[model samples]
Target chain A: MKDRLEIVASGFGGQGVVRLGQTLGEAAVKQGLRVTMLKSHGTEMRGGYVRSQVVLSQKAIDSPMCETPDVFLALSSSAYNRFKDTVPAEGIIVYDPAFVEEIDASLPCRQIAVPAKDIAVRNFKRPIFSNAVALGSLAKLLETMLEKNVVLESFLEVIPKYKDENRNAFEMGYETMNI
Target chain B: MKRFLETGNFAITEGAILGGCRFFCGYPITPATELAEAMSLRLPQVNGVYLQAEDECAAMHLCIGASLGGMKSMTATSGPGFILYADPYGWALGCEAPMVVMNSGRVGPVSGITGAPGQGEFYLTRYPTQGGNFETITLAPNSAQECLKIIVEAFYLSERLRMPITVLGDQLLTDGMEDISVPENDDEMKEMGLRVWPRLYHKGPDFYPASDALDIPPVQMGYDTGALCSDWTPTVEGYDIEEVEEHHKHAYRLIYKVRNNPQLYEDFYEKKYMDDDPDLVVVSYGTPSRVVNTAVERARSEGLKVGALRLINLWPFPDRHFSRKTKYLVVELNWDGQLVREVQRAAPKDAEVKFLGCCGDLPTIPDLMETFTKMLKNQPLERKGWVLEAW
Candidate 1:
């Protein structure tokens, strides 16, 4: 069986980490792929660390939990340090340079740091849209399977009223990703 | 249609309404509070009555009263609230009033967590209520969609059997959201008999009229009897029971009626999957059964030839289905081996029974898969206890 792709998104609570994971999982489901999304939150809803794992495959997923992730998206420095070691050898580490300033320089996997929060604030006028920007970047990285337009459409489906801001945030991330 | 994406709570509320439930009384409890909130908002639009009672006990009793008055009624509460309504639940059983109780279970024995999921109430609902000889029908759904479908069925079954039925749902199923097709119209529902309530009491002044009495109202409690009183003892002509033999006879008759007419279960998979004259059977229910089902499929793929038996109706335990070929019986549940004991007693003497249990907020599917793999491989299955942390 082909290996399934598992993505883990981590950040502080209320950073849209859960929503970002859900949007990607829903996009996968919409594309006729089997997906499972598992989310965990700490006691405090605002500052405590929150994480979500999204598993995608052509076959039915047996368990929702992911022990090793293929891609780890850490929007906060603390979350990056906490989960960086769990990524597999061939995994990719994507971080927000605006918040996560340091990373283990000797890590084996490919690393990409983007100014997600800066882009969100500068272009969308909302720092909360950073997660949407990160989602667009992640979609670009997985361009072989998912289209940038599909990710933008899924983001629109989730953020019901903020059409212009969300679209701009997604576009900024799409343009930033060299891939 | 206004496509307001709904939560699991709203789905269940809509399903209950589709089931013809016109009266809902409940107390607010976490995880389950959303169910009441949705019902409160929608009930008025449908011309239904939704009351938030002072406490769970009052809420349960209020549902019983509404049900007795011949309106399809229900109540939703969590574990703590379920305990409070134990007495009222027993009374409803004794009186043979049909109503549905939705238990959106959370972690606990005593308010463990407000927003976590737990399947600890598996055995509590499986047994008879407050020293009764019979068990109420309990249905557990793994997904929010099933939550919607099952509550409607619960009402139908409860009314059909003249017994209170419970939808034993956990926070995972109650709080999660899913895409569900809206239910059909009243005419379609009537065609499927989803709106029908069974004949319990005799109808009208005349027992047998010259014409077909299809339009006459059924002879309900207050209309048929002269007086209304809250007496536990069976009263003949509205007087307190003086005869001991008559009271015993009345109680025994009611108990026997329910016990004898136990609801038969619907086996999810075929009996042949029990194996080509296989040596073991795995007994499970609810969410655990879904894991078992996955494990059985995996085992079959590995050429182990194992099978699963899931009890849709846990209460009316299908004792008649036990067989000599069933050599080993494994009972898996989310509680600390609570239902295993019952399965062990019910299995044949030649069959060896074992328990693979957990009290974790969410039972690990991998653990179940590993256990089933070991059992099918003829390896010794490890026995351990699990105590999940409070949220």
Candidate 2:
């Protein structure tokens, strides 16, 4: 985190969008990076659109909310459509190809596709573990600022239980990313 | 020892435990509900009690009773629940029971949007109850770590002042997660004055006549349920008295305890960039101050002489933190200019006070930077003074 960088995970609620960002934030903090994660949820509990903006910096973070995210993780198609136009030109977009079908590549950002949900369902027999896969992919995109072990440790710290499958899903996602 | 990553609500609960809060009575509400949840889990580990009351009203009554029974107590709520608390809240003030309330305010009039952050309760915290010459101590924490630190202060001040103290945050701050640095040693926490003093578990009879303002040892309610703690005027000796002299002495004491002791209950504020002699100073409290920090830095990068002042303590309005020579901009997340009225009132007569307030949504740094830029150049504002939503 040179100046300040924000990573946003956007998806329909219950995809663990907030948890993905929260795990990253906690991992960043474990590395002594200043981090703030802002949770956004619709009034209705589950199935509604949800997003979380996690800002990390070497110094103190002034604003908790992120205007333009450096790394945008789209777990759903609606999530990809919502922020494609808003991401900065040099920013990167990481989307789950299994969920996000369409992408406007001309929007001036690097787009990387990962089969997060597919891998989670096939390997673990649980779609809920997609958040871990998504988080691991997000960490790959943020590798310059956060190490792979740091992200894995954060997942273990935050997940509370089911360490083995989450770890396998995370490793699969991490291996899928080229970064 | 390493500091843990915590949400604002969890940090408050952890800090309350460090502050020696032995009793927690609260009802569930969004944003603030986690504080109650955390308390239910953690209080028992510290040998404390956690009671989930039926409603905000009953929650506060239980809080009052717990504190009277001689344990540092607390409760948590949000916009609508905070309003429900006013009934018993007044008696807590009259009886001078030391209690801390953590209110994570949300967008509201009545059970409004639960996720959006709002500062509508800023003024409500000051005058929580009706018909009394009472003063409230309120602290607004901007981050998870500050949420922890500030709650400890809230509990400390409530005990020191013998009044209900409030820690005012918002949905953003409460739900927001961050790595918070805390004291490594419990001994350090005690040495730093985070310990509770009022463990009045079993004071003998005749403890009722003690003066709360004087910081005299208090009696347990189990000994005397009618410990002269009625909402009505009480005699200095701790009994109901409707007589003129007794009422005069009683009410004034309630007000003067905070007024005369600036050394004790004075406003706590944090000032930044004032030494740089900035042309414009932004005043804000709670989560809005985070945006002001960004705007201030952005303004400096753009070569504008701008600074920021964040109010950690909301009540007793720390006007003394202002530099009268500089133009001031007051920002908040409430419509109709409730806090700006205080900015206008407390700021020096010669100082120019500008208001840029928004409700239902947060004020962005770009908007603040643009407004401050216009104000700095003496340019006619596109909008100024209580910029309400276009009705």
Candidate 3:
């Protein structure tokens, strides 16, 4: 990261929204960047609105959250709806169209829709790996700041199990370089 | 030597282990549960014992018992659970036992939302227990790295002064993750003066474990040391004493242990861009301090004479930090205004004081930037706290 890149990953509980932020944060740390991540979830464990704020900077990250994010990655429509209008005109939004049904055109930011869950379920038969797919999509969309390979390697390090399947899911989403 | 991306709770667990916390007696609570989980797995690899108590009260007593047996002990809890551990905490103080208590404070009064962050237990960490007046050191670290560093200090301050110490980590910090560097090897730790106090051992045939040296951990209970661990004021021989004059000596030692040694139990603060005597200095701790730091820089870039003082040591009030010529703006994560009251009492009389606080969310950068800008122009504060819409 050059100065500071604020990233927000939002989805329902068990959708691995927090894990996506963590994987990105861990990769940033390994890349010699300062990183801070705060994960918030509702009372419901399964379907609650879950959000993780990841801030990366060349210098120490004083705070993690920003009202206008540099990147917003949404796995669910509720997640996208909750934070759609929050990003600035220069910011970017990477959403998995498999879950996010609607997008606000007035958001005034670059928007890309990736079928991350669809790719995960169709290729690996495991929707749980959708987070890794979404992360790969996000990395590709924000490729100028972060390296796609570095993000994938960090996911491998963070998720100890289901190695081959998770990597495949990330690759499948990474192949969708249309953003 | 190595950097690891870990949560504040994970940092605390490793920090305690590095500081020689061989015994962890804790009851899990939200935001603090992961600390216990990490300890349960990590402690055993280092030949330490991780005991899961039924409740916070029992956890506090268990730590006391372990400390008495010559083990550096710790117990982790949140707001409601910390209250349960209060009475046993008093016992630890009265007996002059050295232990560390981790309070991952949450929104509270009753069983508030466990996920939400708050500095609700700011005062509770210091004077939670009833009875005789005693002083304890409380440390508030803003980052995961600081969490790892201060917990080692927590164990040290507790043992060196022979009293309990509290490390307050709010939910925002505790549950969050950050990149931090910890002492990965013995040499690195040694260079940083990471010392662990060994338990007190009585080698004599008629040895009294709980003698005058109740300050340190007593003899191993299995070794047959005549140690009567009592909450009441005790004699040099470890027996309870009812006399007022004798109690005076005992009480005086306990109360003045950390208070008298100002140099040893001194405060730790962070001052960024305050060299030229700024007109307004934002005072805060824990997670909210991060935003204030950002706001200070934002305000500074705009030619506003603004600075920040992040209080590392919460207790002893760090009254020495505030001075004249520069006014103070107190920021915190609680509605009770605990930090402002301290600022009002300790800061210079001529210094103008302001308060900005919240419970669930932190004081954001934009709100603080505006507040600092208005305060510099002598504009009245729009709201009690720093939220923008309401202000």
Top DockQ prediction, candidate number: 2
Estimate, for each residue in B90-148, the C-alpha lDDT of model 3 and write its tens digit. 98887767899999878877887777788988788778798746777789989898887
- The CA lDDT at A20 in model 3 is 88
Q: Write the per-residue lDDT of candidate 1 for residues B125-236, one digit (tens) a residue.
A: 7652666545566777665555666778887677655668888876655664433445567665555444434435533344212221123232245655542325364443
Indicate the worst ten consecutive residues by lDDT in candidate 3 chain B: B203-212
Runs in model 3 deviating more than 4 A are B192-225, B384-391
lDDT of 3 at B268: 69
Candidate 2 residue runs with Cα over 4 Å from true position: B190-214, B222-226, B322-325, B383-391
Predictions' DockQ, in order: 0.23, 0.73, 0.70
- Candidate 2 or 1, higher TM-score: 2
Overall local distance difference test of candidate 1: 0.69
**Model 2: per-residue lDDT, tens digit, A2-81?**
68998888988888888788788888888888989888777778888888888988887878877788889987888889
Error of 2 at B352 (Å): 2.9
Worst 10 residues of 2 chain A by lDDT: A40-49
lDDT of each residue in A148-175, candidate 3, tens digit only: 8888888888888998988878887777
